[model samples]
Target: MRILVTNDDGIFAEGIYDLAKALQDIGEVIVAAPNSERSATGHAITIHHPLRVDKVRFFDTTIEAYSISGTPADCVKLAVEALLKDRRPDIVISGINNGPNLGTDVIYSGTVSAAVEAAIMDIDSIAISMGSTNITQYTDAANFVCRIAKEIIHNNDIKDTIININYPTCPKEEVKGVKVTTLGVRKYENTFIERKDPRGNSYYWTSGNVVDMEQNQDSDILALQNGYISITPIHFDLTHFKTFEKIKKLNFQK
Candidate 1:
């Protein structure tokens, strides 16, 4: 299988590097990622500026890697449309991210957005994330993601699906088990902070921490907290099914 690997944390990020290595064992892995961190960039694309892709070499791997001056989604789109035009990838895997992307946080995650973009192209994809900010042992998370990626590649029924996987910040043995979960409720406080520059120009920066909400035990965040890997099936369709029946009763055409 031919797999395309990309991330929001840039091509040099330890997470993506380790992930690419792990995935190399499964198939031909190509890495194309942002030149710098594009965290929380969501599903943005670069249209105003001409997208530039530069080939880069990292460590001993001679993989064809591109450093895009764009968001994660742009990297995926460019990889499919421009870079790998000769042979399309069988799957696209994003992340092994620096931190967890749980609940509503997926909406703001560039890591998840890359995978979503691949899925939009009718290819199977996945977003992998570690549950801790500390970068001590990302290899464990990469190994775990490799196992899931194998499953995704081998499962024909899941060809049209996109999954988000989160690994807990713990040793391999301490991991409870894998749990298929739903997005949890994430609350936040103080989204912005005001600061003054050296020239005394006032500016505001967005900053906030995720607040865990109490929900059913089957939530993605709770599963990560309990030392289990969380896997959530994500879809691009954002239609609210419960509201459809009520809206249909309005009789707008009448």
Candidate 2:
């Protein structure tokens, strides 16, 4: 099996390295990611500037890797359309991210966006992230990714779906179980810190306290909090069918 591994944590990040290394046991891993951190860069593709890709020797060359001067979405899009067009990968795995991409925050996650890009191309994908900031637990997450990938390879029913996996902060042994969950409400309070630059220029830094408003237990947020791994099947289609049906009742003339 050929796996295209990627992340928003940059090519040099240890998270990607650990992921690529661990994934090698399952398949041929080719990593294409941003040269610098592109965290929270949604589904943006570079159009104004030429995307520059550089061949790099990552982790002793067992894993073929490239660094792109763009966002996470750009990396996977370019890889599928240009880099690996001759032999498309069996699966696209985006992350082993150092942070959690739970709830509605997936909308802002470059890691998840990478997988979404793959789904747009009709390729099976997985977006894996650690629920904690700790990098030490990436091994457990990567192992879980292999198991999930191997199992999902045969189940094409959810062919266009993106499996979003978030590992809990606790140790692997302590993990309760896996929970199939839905996206929950994760909003942040709009608060910014005004600061002065070295030249005394005013700058505003955006920092908001997270406000989770999920009342249901079937949410990814709640599952993670309950010490279980959260696996959410997500897609790029944002059409609300009920809302569409409601609007159709109005029957406005074109």
Candidate 3:
């Protein structure tokens, strides 16, 4: 079993390293990640600039790792297309992400986007995230990730879906259990702060607090908030079949 591990967080981030270490016992782990933090970068792939990859020392001597100068999506693209050209990985796992990618947050998350890219290429993929900003809970998240990956690798019925998981910020014992959920909506109280530079030039900094808009009981955000791991299956097909049929019923100028 070969696994390609990646993260929106830089190659040196604690989350990625911990995840890699956890999965090393499972199979051959090869890591390809951004050279710097690329959080919330979405599914952007580089087509203009030339990408650069360099071997980096991650764990003392276990997994083969590389630092990539591109987005999270680019790492997976280059890994399969360039690095592991002869042998495609059996599965791709993106992140024990430093933060949660619940609800609509996945739309802007490079962590989840990396997994989406793998799914686009018809590869089995999963994205793991921890709800807390603290790094201490990553082990618990990694354990769950390992479990899911093992299940997918051994089970054939689990194909055709990208698994998105989020672990709450609590002790492993406090976790209730895993909950299969749907995507919830989350809005943010966006704010911009203006400051003066050394030359008295005005600069603006963008920041926002994520507003809790969760009302659905079976939502990913709600599940995580209630101390349960959230698992949401994501797919790339954006067609609104119901809406398409409704529109098709309308007679227009053909």
Note each model's CA RMSD in angstroms: 1.6, 1.6, 1.6
- Which portions of model 3 miss their true places by more than 4 Å? 196-202, 251-254
* TM-score for candidate 2: 0.95
For 1-254, candidate 1 gives per-residue lDDT tens digits of 89999999988998998899888888898999999999999999988988888999965797778899999999999999989999799999999899999998899999999999999999999999998886577888888777888888888888667899998888788889999999998778757788999999999998776665687788998898888999999998999999989988897885
**Tens-digit lDDT track of model 3 for 1-254:** 89999999899988888899999889899999999999999999999999999998886756899999999999999999889998799999999898899888899999999999998888999999988786565777887788889999888888778999998878888889989999889889999999999999999999999885736999998898888999999898889987998998898987
Task: Determine which window of 10 residues in candidate 1 has minimal summed lDDT.
Answer: 207-216
How big is the positional error of residue 115 in model 1, measured in Å on the Cα after superposition? 0.3
Q: How big is the positional error of residue 128 in model 2, measured in Å on the Cα after superposition?
A: 0.2
The TM-score, computed over Cα atoms with residue i paired to residue i, of candidate 3 is 0.95
Model 1 stretches astray by more than 4 angstroms: 197-201, 251-254
Candidate 2: which stretches are off by over 4 Å? 197-201, 251-254
Candidate order by lDDT, decreasing, is 3, 2, 1
